[model samples]
Target: MIRKCRFAAMLAFSAMMSTAALVQAQAADLLSTLNSTHVLTIGTSNDAPLAYIDPQTKAAVGALPDLLRAALPLMGVKADVRAVAMPFSSLIPALQAGRIDMIGDGIYATAKRRQVIDFTSNTFYNPEALDVAKGNPDNLHQLSDLCGHSAGTYEGTTYVDQLKQASAACPAGKPIDIHLYPTIQNVFADLTAGRLNAGVVDSSLSAYALKQNPALSFELVADYKPADKAGSACAFGVTKGNDAFLAGFSKAYATMLADGTAAKIFTKWGLTPTSFFLSL
Candidate 1:
């Protein structure tokens, strides 16, 4: 009985020690380690103008990726940023699990999200917009206009909540038909096929889609709610409690904003410097 008891205690102690070591390993400064290794693994998504796999080059190209490439060098580290494409909803969890070092896919830094992840200061402001088929069949100009019509939005995006708000306050008490998609591309696809009357997405994405494929037969209604442009200001996301990485990233990101590197990238992706550098 005594030997069995000793063995059980030893096992428990070893397990606790292993857990502590794992916690310590995860608590190391990510920025310093990346600086030493000259590599960064970023979790991203297929959101155009933010982060997506470029069709031509089959490489990740967008405002967020470009900004990271430019800003990391400012942190005394010349990093080769490798963006791994995943669903938008998976980015945060992956960061927390230490599967990815950072997220550069234009994750909005909302108060609720701040509890689970750390973000650099506001990098860009994306106003909500309605994307409709060519000729504006439904004439859906804004969020309110979606009432009594089908609306498409991606899961885990601010746009989903925006649509729901519009639905609840619909003047005629007609709830908007909400359709959830796994990705922005899925929403756009359904909208294009007339499966959905409109899709609520970032204005920048609407513009990029139209610019990239003029024959897509889609039109953007920018400033959907001109009077109240209630939208998220997005930034890069890191693990929630990784203060070391957050501080270093924030400093380097601020430098990028000051040096016009961020603006240049956003402009290349069809966003104005004023919109992208909201709180620069």
Candidate 2:
């Protein structure tokens, strides 16, 4: 019986190794296929600064796409990196369903998301903020202040999960009413219409929107630090098991950092840089 047990253990180990090898092979084949095709479809949101449609040219152009155009060539990928602007909530689904090759816009690699999709190394970091009315009627500043109020944000974003967590932690079981919208524009519209007291979003995005519409009466109610230790590190989202693509993409990204390309991209968008990681 002991010998049989040992044989079973060995068989299990062998099976595991075989599965890993198969995954690696698939990843390599994917890279080769993409290289031969000479094009990579990138899914992004109309979230300004990070990525959005340029009003003048009607082309998708922003920090994320600019960074990709600068670094992809270093990886020997001389392809037309096309950007497809879609609703914020739809980017992930499109990536997972093979409708797009990658997610170019800002996506936080939270533990829950990591289970479904893979992320490249940390590209940049920014904190969450509360976008309130111009005169600060609600007097909101931090996460706790949102406990009993209505909060608006885009659906399927890290902000939504953070707000939910904040609501769950409210004292005396008084939860905040979290309202999710399909796009950031909807959140802004509701906020302007007095439908929402505040909207939780990335601080940088809030700044961009406020700048774009100077007449809009919206003000950021101070930056809020989330309880989650990860904070908000943005990275490129990719299909799970695509290890070959990740490896090449990560290496090219490092090259960008070494040569000062990364800093320029962030500065152009008015966003600060984050710590580097070969993998997230």
Best by lDDT: 2
TM-score for all models, in order of appearance: 0.87, 0.82
What's the CA error at residue 34 for candidate 2, in Å? 3.1
How many residue pairs clash per model?
Answer: 0, 0
Which run of 10 residues does model 1 get worst, by summed lDDT?
222-231
Residue 28 deviation, candidate 2, in Å?
Answer: 5.1
Write out the backbone clash pairs for model 2: none
Candidate 1, residues 1-280, lDDT tens digits: the string is 9999999999999999999998987777777778687878888877888887777786768888888788777667787877788888888899888788888786778888888888876677776678898878888887778889999988888777878888999977588999998888888888888899998877777778878888776788644563234346777888755677677768888887778777777778787645534542
Off by over 4 Å in 1: 1-20, 55-58, 171-173, 226-231, 273-280
Residues 229-267 of candidate 2 have per-residue lDDT tens digits of: 355777889887777777888899888988888888877
Task: Tell me the TM-score of model 1.
Answer: 0.87
